[model samples]
Target: MAKRELTPEEKARNGRNIALALGLIAFVVIVFITTIVRLGGNVVQRTF
Candidate 1:
């Protein structure tokens, strides 16, 4: 089968999707880091 080229709208939608995914990933990373920092070293000292 031959590969088909993407139309302008498809390319734009793909770009937007990529940007949204990157933004979401960045947000999660930021939240994770903030949580870790707020928790500090005491997290390791907790007993079960």
Candidate 2:
């Protein structure tokens, strides 16, 4: 089967989707790092 090319709208949508995904991933990573830093090395010794 022959491959088809993407329309301009499809390209734009793909770009936007990629940007949103990257932004979300970055946000999650930042939050995770912040949580780890806030917890620190003593996290293991702390009682729940």
Candidate 3:
């Protein structure tokens, strides 16, 4: 089967979607890291 070529508009939309997904992933990772760092000290010295 022959591969289909994407039109310019479709390509642009695809690129934008990929960028948006990556940005969301990065934001989530940053938030997770920040939360972990903020709580890391407390976690080590808990009594219970």
Candidate 4:
């Protein structure tokens, strides 16, 4: 079996898609971290 090769345009599109996916993942991680911090602060306040 032979592997398929991508044209220049297709490669460019793939690069763009990868960047977009990474950006979205970063945004989600930031939101999750923020939620955890807020939850932790609330727990600390209650303990004191």
Candidate 5:
């Protein structure tokens, strides 16, 4: 099957969608790392 060329508007929309997806993924990863770091110190309890 032959692929058709994307118009300027379609190309722009596709680029915006890709950027949004990547930005969302990055935000999630940052939040996850922050949570892990913040909670990591208290995870292990010391016995007296």
Candidate 6:
């Protein structure tokens, strides 16, 4: 049996998809860290 091959256009599209996925993951991590910091700030409020 022979395996199917990917053309140059298909390869480029796959690479672009992977890059977009990584960018989205990075964005989510940044948002998560910012949310944690904001939440912690509220929890550690000072009483003056």
Per-prediction TM-score:
0.87, 0.87, 0.88, 0.78, 0.84, 0.74
Of 1 and 4, which scores higher on TM-score?
Answer: 1
Better of 3 and 5 by TM-score: 3
Error of 6 at 5 (Å): 1.3
Q: Give the alpha carbon lDDT tens digit for every residue of 1-48 in model 3.
A: 998999999999999999999999999999999999999989899899
Please report, in order, the local distance difference test score of every candidate based on alpha carbons: 0.97, 0.96, 0.97, 0.93, 0.93, 0.92
Lowest lDDT 10-residue stretch of candidate 2: 39-48
- Superposed by TM-score, candidate 2 places the C-alpha of residue 47 at a distance from the truth, in angstroms, of 3.4
Among all candidates shown, the one with the greatest TM-score: 3
Q: Candidate 1's residue-wise lDDT over 1-48, tens digit each?
A: 998999999999999999999999999999999999999987998888
* Clash number for each model: 0, 0, 0, 0, 0, 0
Q: Rank the candidates by lDDT, best first.
A: 3, 1, 2, 5, 4, 6
Report how far off residue 30 is in candidate 2 (Å): 0.4
RMSD of each: 1.2, 1.3, 0.9, 2.9, 2.8, 3.7
> Which has the greatest lDDT?
3
Candidate 5: lDDT of 18? 100
Task: List residue ranges in candidate 3 displaced over 4 A.
Answer: none
TM accuracy, model 6:
0.74
Instruction: Predict model 2's lDDT versus the native.
Output: 0.96
Clashing pairs in 4: none
Model 2: how far residue 34 lies from native, Å: 0.4
lDDT of 2 by residue, 1-48 (tens): 998999999999999999999999999999999999999987998888
